[model samples]
Target: MYVGGGAGNVGGAAVTLASRAGARVVATARPEDAAEVRHLGAAEVLDYRSPDLGEQLRRAAPGGYHVHLDTSGRGLLADAVDLLAPGGRLVAMTGLGRGAAELPLGRLYTRDASIVGFALSNAATADLAEAAEGAVGALGDTPWRPRIADRLPLSRTAEAHRRMDAGGVRGRLVLTVGAADGR
Candidate 1:
């Protein structure tokens, strides 16, 4: 599996999960996140921000990946499809541009590749709360661990959201939502 994103919450979690699932997982992120992604068990980490990102990813996944999960969007999607092997599957989870994408159909037809859209809100239809707990439990014995970028008091959640919105936040931005006052 090849996953693209690199420096956001969805990208990080997908890296860990894909690695744990025994894929020959190659992940893409910015230069600053390569080490953290390696620690997450990625076999190779490419710089997604590089001007030659498509070429870099192709090099890392020479045989091409059967599956590609994108937490970014279609600009990257266009590149990701170029890396697809015949019959490859690409799933995009970001509503980066209203969740609608414009792809080059000729290539998709030639490769016989399929692109699917996903929204995690769909998790609400299933027993996802339990499933999430189960997923976390399944990994307890493994080396997987999410890094916390910052911890702030509950009242500071506004600032946390602001920082996350402004971009460039890595790992997880944890809001300590329930600590007693004056602790």
Candidate 2:
């Protein structure tokens, strides 16, 4: 399996969860974040921006990935589709850009590959609970903590969004509902 955006908040969590699930995770991260992504449990961490990303991905798992989770959404669908094993699934969560992104339909269809994009908040509560339970089960006795990159008060909500838009902030950007002190 492959996890894109392996260093970001959601990606980091995905790596950890996927690892705990006994999957051999090959993930991509920025050069600086490679260590943390590896620490989170990716068997191999590659630079997402590498010139030969396709080659690297192929070399990492020549048989191809059964599942590709794209948290960063860097327009890797075509490349991912090329590397999908039979009946592979691509879960693209972010970077659903306004402009059209081309995909290799012939290849995708021939391999019986499918692509899906979803928002976690849109998931049913029952499903969420089930996933949470599974995450806990996967952890065994290990403790888990979300990777938080920044914390801002509610008053700066717009600023937080801007930071997210800029795509430089790493991990989860936590926003307090109010001031640090009760207000």
Candidate 3:
């Protein structure tokens, strides 16, 4: 498995989940994110900004990846398709470039590859309930504890957004949406 954008909170969660699910995951990030990706349980890390993305990914997963989960969605679906073996699956969740893109549909069909857009809210109600329960249970596990970068008061929301937009903070940027005292 190959997980793209494996440095941020969501990406790190993907890497950890994939690893815990017993898949050998190779995670990609920027050059500065190598350590964080490794800490997230990536067997290997690739710098997406490098010119040798395909080469590095192939080297990391010699048999070709069976699945690709893209979190960045920065015009990576085409190259990701080329990196997969026949009958592989691409799960995309982000729209960094735009909400719509022109993918290589013919190539995907020819190779029996599949591109699935994930919608967390689209799951059946019962399934969602069960999954929610499972998630709540999983939270009790030590490894599932959310990594909180910092907690800021609501007054600093603008600064929090700025820091998040700048992509400088690690882990989750938590904001105290409401105060305990009646304000």
In angstroms, give how far residue 14 of model 3 lies from its true place: 1.5
List the candidate 2 regions with Cα displacement exceeding 4 Å. 125-144, 178-182
Which candidate has the highest lDDT of all? 2
Extract clashing residue pairs from model 2.
none
Candidate closest to the true structure, highest TM-score: 2
Candidate 3 collision pairs: none
In model 3, the runs with Cα more than 4 Å from the true position are: 96-99, 121-133, 139-145, 165-169, 177-182
- By TM-score, the better pick of 1 and 2 is 2
RMSD of each: 2.7, 2.6, 3.2
When 1 and 2 are scored with lDDT, the better candidate is: 2
The lDDT values for all models are 0.76, 0.83, 0.77
Candidate 1, which ten residues in sequence have the lowest lDDT sum? Answer: 174-183
| Count of backbone collisions in candidate 1 | 0
